[model samples]
Target: MANRHGPCMEKKCSWCCDPVKVPANFSDEKIPLDKEGKRIWRDREEIVVPESQMETVRLKTFDCDLLDTQTGKCSDYENRPEICRNTSCVDEKSTKSVDEQHRETLEEELIPLKGKK
Candidate 1:
């Protein structure tokens, strides 16, 4: 992965022009979730993660496993869309800080919103 793009990383993030992480898969798309505050890029045909990449996406939970070991591009680039082709990490906040950052993402979280569980 490091050799494919000769280190596909810089000192800044492609999006928001913020100094970000290693900068992998910065091309990921922005998907909107119907459940409110959740989303992911998907093909115009199937509005969901493909079965073949289900585990891969699930394992990435918060985009941890999306990092490519070769070109640093997403392992699923060929199957990705324009949105996924433009995603980037934040510069100063953890990806998990949806509240503090108030940013949107394609990922979802399980929480007791109304204390039902």
Candidate 2:
């Protein structure tokens, strides 16, 4: 089975493909602020697929605008956004621990989008 980071080296798997949902605050659009002017993050739900079932399950929730469904690849891999560059599908306990730290780092990189819609 491919790690949760993504597909194995040679073969291409649709593990990270179209219709996958992401946090609404993932974009550069302005995040709504609450009454106290606190950033209101989207109520993003995490999909925790068990490592054993990663390959067998058909994910139909990928919402990434950059995915190329025809080729089963990212349209702009070289210049893909930071979030895309950092994500993986490899599933291991040790990797998960590392990924957790990495996720925190990514979250820190987010600059709240200013200006209202």
Candidate 3:
């Protein structure tokens, strides 16, 4: 639960290790980042066509880890994929709203699970 603008040590994924890119994680599609470290994902939006491999790839969540422990160092550091190695996250930015979002998402999901209709 690190502030998007806080120090790296202060901010970390709550679900996984630190951001670690291995050889396999690298990809030609380099993720662009803003000065504050926010990723520019707009370019791919237009390119993801319907029922294409790229479209399928788009469905895959790139969120590395939700915890601090699983980010900087790869879980499979020795055998990570190139695409994973090249993946990047907005570390410098304060995706701080995450906490709020997480809570809201969970609440929404739970409502469905509770069969409260």
Which candidate number maximizes lDDT?
Answer: 2
TM-score of 2: 0.37
User: Sorted on lDDT, highest at the top, how do the candidates line up?
Assistant: 2, 3, 1
lDDT of 2 by residue, 34-59 (tens): 45765433332333332334433321
Error of 3 at 54 (Å): 18
**After superposition, which runs of candidate 3 have C-alpha atoms over 4 Å from their true positions?**
1-58, 61-74, 91-117
Best by TM-score: 2
How many backbone clashes are present in model 1? 11
lDDT of 1 by residue, 27-97 (tens): 33433232354443332221223244443332111332333545444544445434443444332445454
TM agreement with the true structure for every prediction: 0.20, 0.37, 0.21
Point out where model 1 deviates above 4 Å: 1-65, 86-117
Candidate 1 Cα lDDT to native: 0.31
User: Given candidate 3, what's the lDDT at residue 80?
Assistant: 38
Candidate 1 lDDT score at position 5: 19
Per-residue error for 102 in candidate 3, Å, reads 15
